[model samples]
Target: MPDGTELIVTRSPPVNSNGVITLTNRHLPQLKWQESLLIARPVNQFRDFFPEVNNQNLTEIAIEIKETYNDYLKSARSLEDLKNRHPELREPYIEVTSAKSQRTIYLTRLDRFGTLESVFFSQDKQFPVDLQLVNNKIDREIPNSLLAVATLDLEGKSVEQPIGAIALSSVEEYNLKAGINM
Candidate 1:
């Protein structure tokens, strides 16, 4: 782990096996890119990064983002409809800025094989984080695990490294744990 990076641990359910589970630990950097875009934390948590912006204004900016995304989804009946209703949605990425601070965040959406790829955001022209999901093959004795790697690029190219893994729980097991009946 690098300086100012925190480790996040998550559990992954076993696949086609008995009661075995895999746990993954990921390194999360405390950079503005991560704080402002990657994780789903409170807006106030990153206020220091934007000293000029107040908490209330930051909260409003967050709400506006959500509402815009919701509006995009609701009006996305067709490609033409999306382009006509919200011209911004037609672009591969969207850029938003804070009114008071003038701090900007760029959001990029990628898709492959009819499935949504990673949606990355950054506070600069170049993306700072590149994440990938990798499946790890294991023997019959051990539980299966999936690895999530985050490649951080700061200072243009001085520091870049892969850090992180994620585990998903089985639906049946999760339901049982939550006391939900099917």
Candidate 2:
């Protein structure tokens, strides 16, 4: 995004065309899926591949996501019901992001070209521990919140104190999965 903000890029078919992943209605199994299916918050049209502007008012980022099909609602929060209604929206997308509570993140990366990715095993061969294995609804509330992040040298030791938690959401959940329920 030119505004130096983050975007929640969501796509219905979840196409990984070239290096870009999309959650748009452009490519669908059925054309009608564009109507009732692939419902999302719809990212602001200003966002681009990279940040080119220094936007200080970076708050309330409504990231696009694949939600349910409530005609009156902009983005549906029910996955199970959406599944029962639109069974054609298949594959790991609906399966991966489905959650009773909390949230499910399929994967995360740090490269601009998708040239390299983090791996759970050493054989995959990657750099930097950019992936955070957090599974809590409270911590996941903030759109682009930072958590206990630290860097290390080859020996793998904390190079600095992890950054403090930034809660953009004033609606604090002091007890929501407060005890590592994941």
What tens digits encode model 2's per-residue C-alpha lDDT throughout 1-182? Answer: 99999988586464557543243444554445334665344445546744564554443232222122333363244665655544433332211221344343222222211223322222344333332323323334434343323233445654432222322221132332222221
State in Å the error of residue 145, model 1.
2.4
Give the alpha carbon lDDT tens digit for every residue of 1-182 in model 1: 86989877797544553333312122234324534533335657776886775589867987899788767756654666645544434436433343544433322222211113323332335443344444433222223243333454555764422232122232122221221111
Cα deviation at 169, candidate 1, in Å, is 1.3
Candidate with top lDDT is: 1
User: Which lDDT value does model 1 have at 152?
Assistant: 46
**lDDT (0 to 1) per candidate:** 0.40, 0.34
- For every candidate, C-alpha RMSD to the true structure in Å: 26.3, 26.4
Clash pairs detected, candidate 1: none
lDDT of 2 at 128: 38
C-alpha positional error of residue 167 in candidate 2 after TM-score superposition, expressed in Å: 16
